[model samples]
Target: MTTPLLMLLILTLPLLANRLVGRTAAPAATEAAAAWGLGLVFLFTASGHFVQAEAMTQMLPPWVPLRLALVHATGVLEIAIALGLFTRRWRTAAAFAAATVLIAFFPANVYAALQHAPMGGHAWGPVYLLVRAPLQLILLGWTWGFLLRGRTPKRMPSRA
Candidate 1:
């Protein structure tokens, strides 16, 4: 339920991106990318809720071998990054944070794939590991390019 809603939100982001980029070409694609990237970050967090939906209404995936304290920390970071993405001043920072988080979660994806963990009875576990594992790195690069490169103003201040 939440996953679909988050996916819808992600798909709608391009519309928001178009409007945001139209306002100023300086941030331009970078801002849109940041928004899109941030949306994914939110979507990723939402997906985790699906993984552990049975135990609690909203909770981390129990399969993950991490302390409760670490899980809470991750939740805090996700919310903070989500908030950061909402404003222009923090957009780039949000992108960076989201990218970092994505990279950090790669191992779990890999483990799931390798372990052949059954998700929703759709088992292609190892295949998923091979396919999606690389995606994390690619997304990191895309966000880095979109946010870091796009955010940089093309014109340097003219030295008199």
Candidate 2:
């Protein structure tokens, strides 16, 4: 629900600010802005790994051991991804990697929902899964859109 909206807002904030300032920003600026925004989101989410360890652990598949350790590792990965997104050299790779991580985590979300495992005090149900599934796709598309789809703007020859 709010995830997509937040992503959209994050995606557009740079361009919106540019417009407000009577300046037209490059399209890549919007993409960069989105990258930065997503980085922050991941960082915030990573905090929950420690803050709600027991509940997060319950969402894990039984075969997985050292639940808290796994959670913390994912948090570290999220933090690394966030930092990577902030770097011009790493944004594209980071975006692609972020999408991969998001996809990898999708199964846990499904498993959690199907089990109706409540984490952070919120109950999970079919309705939540319904929204989450499509949201995953959207998140992937958004990641790809900003980083993978666009061509770099061509520079014109400068005249003397």
TM-score of each: 0.60, 0.79
- lDDT digits (tens) for residues 1-160 of candidate 2: 5654665565556546756887546776777766776777677667778787778887788889998899889988988888988888878777777888989998888878777778632254656777777767766776777666763433457997
Report the number of clashing residue pairs per model: 0, 0
Q: Report the Cα lDDT for residue 103, model 2.
A: 95
Largest lDDT belongs to which candidate? Answer: 2
For model 1, state the Cα shift of residue 143 in Å. 1.0
The per-residue C-alpha lDDT of model 1 at residue 136 equals: 57
Tell me the TM-score of model 1.
0.60
Q: Choose the strongest candidate by TM-score.
A: 2
Window of ten residues with lowest summed lDDT in model 2:
119-128
| lDDT measured at residue 14 in model 1 versus the true structure, 0 to 100 | 64
Clashing pairs in 1: none
Tens-digit lDDT track of model 1 for 1-160: 2433454466456646766667544555546655665566565664454444342211235555554556556666777777776666777777777777878866655655555555421146666655565555555665676666555424446899
